[model samples]
Target: MLTHKGDKSGIRSDFISDYDDLADQWWDPRGPLAPLGWIARARAGFIPVAGHEQARLLDIACGGGLFGPHAAGKGYRVFGVDLSEMSLREALRHGFDEVVRADIARLPFDDESFDVVTAGQCLEHVPDPFGVVAEACRVLRPGGTLVVDTIADTKVARLVSITLAENVPLPGRPPRGTHDHRLFVNRERLTGVAREHGVELELLGLRPRLREMARYAAGRLEEVRMVRTKSTSVLYLGVGIKK
Candidate 1:
């Protein structure tokens, strides 16, 4: 995790600015601002197994508290954290149980502070992913769960991923390259990193279909419209248990 202090918090500062600008839209569940339905879908894949209501959960890089209420409403004790103060403020405005402004790479929590630690789409933007993962591990109790969802890396899917991402009408979402160039990883690489951190893999799957590429080319996009093209551009969703 990169620690940002003083006048320069580095890349995190820049990313926070982007998130802050989109805070209001990000929290809204309706319209283009809502999370691509795939997020709720992906979270569902693990939430059942993770035991939402009884769990002590942390939503790392939870901009505008998008996923927190869903989990909180389910009965989990949710704490949302982000580098953007504006995002946190908006989260608090909506009555989030607790919201903190902290970089995910360097979480300020004590060891084993949470039962489930999640970083959805937030990993790729960090300067030190290994450190961020380590921090997630640090805060999770032994046998706790770690959930991650990020863009997948597949050679066959790259071209289609870029083309569709550019054409898609996602809200609050900018063009592919406008944000920092992303870091894409396959499941083996992801599981390897989790293994290095002593977390056991529980589940891994693509939420949106890989063949959605053909739908875009065939102009039958709505047939797969419910599928999240953004996360499905190849999404890597997994739950790892810390041993």
Candidate 2:
């Protein structure tokens, strides 16, 4: 797990390799796996924003092709892109329409190639989030949707170093091999970047209904503790649109 961030280290490439290595075990939803549940939940959050079956879609950092193929199943023409061939192969195995090897900084597609573009759990690992968003904007049609989900920079996220990501094992993930980042996006940062990139930002709040109760309780009441724990600890999702 190469956690070292470097201009020369092919960090993206290495990250892809790491996921590719775990591709087979990546999608299984039943395990005590942290990433699987998160991915599924993120995909569910994305579907409503993704629009209908007729839309042509591109999923960046598609990993094992979670949302893309599911969208394809719903009647969209879906293309998935990732930095790892190994992960793309798993996506192909699951019947994604197209899987390409590319970087989000510079997508290998013509302008306005997709009606909707989605990225799940990838932004945090990306070195240049603005660059990635710019490419997503460039490749989407004027009214296309860009949906993204990433690890939020909450106090809980700080504890990520000690807490096994609900998906990572008890042994903890190799440093830099998993979430390799110092900062995760907050709503303000996401909005700022989207504005800079010529996109309309929408902060799609993702906390479950119970989470509100929890925030009300933390250190104050026991019932509230449940809600606070889930709310603060849960991954946040946001959506931005290309106008």
Candidate 3:
């Protein structure tokens, strides 16, 4: 049986509720969560999974199990954790190896238990991102990989990703307030937090392909690409290696 520890004290109940409400749509490639699938693919590309086929991966906030299947296909023994039972059910339906409903800030795992830990598009929704990172580090073994991706904390990011992409009411767009500008974490802040946990951080920016963006707006999932860019002013992916 999967162990679930910790209360939801440090978590944002509203955020969990929001995700639970959308749990059914999470796996819909042509739905509001299309961007998340693309983001998960891009984030997975950055992790150096070669020569570690037996490695164990823990995906925090693994809503609908987007990244879990991808990681599992790459031969990692994958486990996912989230706070929403509805979301966990969705993830399980997608055939993830293991899905547990638990708080990210208080992960139920032994120290140095995982070879890879990921928190994609999750930090922004949590009330305590630093606490989540600390727990991720605690669960990661020495030299393990830690992957995270989030909207950058910047004016352009607010204008493009949140205000426009989420609230503009375009086709396939997410609901309003899907993101809170104030909770967005920038590269510097995330790196600092990772460093505090004895992990060296590297930042990578994800730039949307205009054509792909248009296809996404039209609810088409084909050839959706979010490639690396020189600027992380909008969306960014980070990699950390535990020491």
User: Which structure among the candidates has the greatest lDDT?
Assistant: 3
Worst 10 residues of 3 by lDDT: 1-10
Query: Model 2, 149-199: lDDT tens per residue?
Result: 666666666455324442343221233345543445565676677777667
Clash number for every model?
1, 6, 0
Quantify how close model 1 is to the true structure by its C-alpha RMSD in Å. 5.9
Order the candidate numbers by lDDT, best to worst: 3, 1, 2
Greater-lDDT candidate between 1 and 2: 1
lDDT of 3: 0.79
lDDT of each: 0.62, 0.61, 0.79
**Position 86, candidate 3: lDDT:** 82
**TM-score of the candidate numbered 3?**
0.88
RMSD of 3: 4.7
Q: Name the runs in model 3 displaced over 4 angstroms.
A: 1-17, 50-54, 218-223
Scanning candidate 1 in windows of ten residues, the lowest lDDT window is: 222-231
TM-score of every candidate: 0.72, 0.72, 0.88
Task: Give per-residue CA lDDT, model 1, range 1-243, as digits (tens).
Answer: 222222354332323334665655664433333434447445744653445446777888877766654565555677888987877887766546788888787898999878888887776666566677778888988888888876566653454444555447653234344223334555566677778888976544454454753554455653222233333336556687899
